[model samples]
Target: MKKLFLLGILSLFLCVLVGNVALGEEEKISIAYIGASTDLPFWITLRNEARNQANELGVEFIDLTPPSMDAQAQKNSFDNAIQMGVSGIIVGAADSRAFDDSLDKASEVGIPVVAVDTGIDHPHIASLVQTDNLSSAKIAGQYILDHMTRPGKVLIIGGVLGHQTGDARKNGVTEVLEAAGVEVIFRAADWLPEKAYEVAQNELAANPDLTAVFAAWDPGAMSAKSVVAERGLTGKIIIVGFDGDPANLKAIKEGEILATIKQDNVKMGRDSISLLVDIINGKEVPKYIPIDGFIIDQSNVDEFLQ
Candidate 1:
């Protein structure tokens, strides 16, 4: 009878020990991604890559992108993710300064925040993963200066006026073209294709002899290409773009656009997750990670397909 009682107690003790071990095991990390605009292919591709990387790493991924490019909406999403106790956050900021308070709150609560594509001016950002937009924009500017046939009017379709990425690109292009004595007509399309198309259509009709057009973002470039094609100025007016969207790749193949700078968006997404993981693991990470960009033109556009 004593032996039976001892055996039962031993079994109960072993079960408790096993349960404690199971409870002590590390839980899967949860990552929250606050994308700027889901409507943009660039952000969509970035989100997809980040989600894939999170899945590969056995982490839970949450997408918190706003319906549109609304800054306040983005901040609300960040706050919600923080409230949900996310392990980390990868954000493509809609506005550089709008998320400062939410980022600060995340930092205070020990949830690391990494910025991707666009960056904020706040010190709370754990790391920034993006391309050097200014330098890449200069590439397009130099191409226009070297290849433009004449000194006729040149138009620039830029992103949001005060946005960091757009401002950097516009400044870079403006500097290079102004130094080359080219007349630049700058317009902000807010990164909207329809608005870009409207601007391009009106300008193409008015300026007829516009020498070149630089669309600082991929979708804007796509819209500009449509206007140029409709006006029968496909090969005549040099059209350069920024992001390497798949449609832009197709446009390059069809000779609709002259060239575009390809930002490593997949790397941007993957790196953001990697850095956040490192941070979560109590490892040091670089504050800034700059990915390289490629200039895609007809000569090498075939290799970029697929």
Candidate 2:
């Protein structure tokens, strides 16, 4: 009986030693990318960059962006990521406050979340990696002030309602234009080019002498440019856009768009992944990570094109 008891004790000690060794070995972690609609160019680029970064870091990446920017759909994807037991989550929310409950649940489960491009007001968000959109728009508004000699009417086209990015950009433009004594006409396009075109057409009909236009997104800028061209007011109306998409940059080169604010979405994606990895590895990270944006216009358009 004494011999048997000693053998049992020895076996237990070996089991504990093995368990410690296993714990010391690096374990592969999986991260979920909960992006906005993949159809949107900005979100697509962001997602691709995050995926590439995850691959470089040797972490499993799962994409969960919905086909459209629906709040419920994004919530559902978040729930799925939680169920899959991902180590971290990177999100570009469709709506600012739509993912509060889901994010709270992630926190409860100890899954760290990093917001990219769009952010929520949840306490659990580990970091926000995005451009300073408001400041960029303010720069665009300043461009309008410098160019539009006359303080006449100007139109402001925006994306969907309640979209944090759109609202911030619009607020920035409004602040500068209103201060410069420019009459501004505002409209929300819901991120639809057709709606933006229609609104631009109607606004132009009512205010034919409009001096300039501030489009809060690239698509809206394209639509506004089309309207200006159709009305034979291309050179007369200065159209500025947010989101320096390639097409918008082309437009800028062609003089259709006077200028656009370039959001570093790719950097935002890579940074979000890097921060999430740090959080998962028990490293400290800031609550907010700001990425700078630049104004791309005729003077600097060639440099961007190259």
> What ranges in model 1 sit over 4 Å off?
1-25
| Residue 240 miss distance in model 1 (angstroms) | 0.9
In candidate 1, what residue range of length 10 has the lowest lDDT sum?
Answer: 20-29
Residue 217, model 1, lDDT? 91
- Write out the backbone clash pairs for model 2: none
Q: Give the distance in Å from residue 304's predicted Cα in candidate 2 to where it truly belongs.
A: 1.9
Candidate 2 wrongly placed segments (more than 4 Å): 1-26
1-306: candidate 2 lDDT, tens digit per residue: 899999999999999989877765435678989887888777788889998999998888899989977778988999999999899998888778788788889989999999988767888999999889888888988889899966688899987778888898888888998997888888998777789999999999998778999988888899999999998988789999887888889999998889999998889889999999999999999999888788999999888774
Best by lDDT: 1
**Count of clashes in candidate 2:** 0
For residue 66, model 2's alpha carbon misses the true position, in angstroms, by 1.4
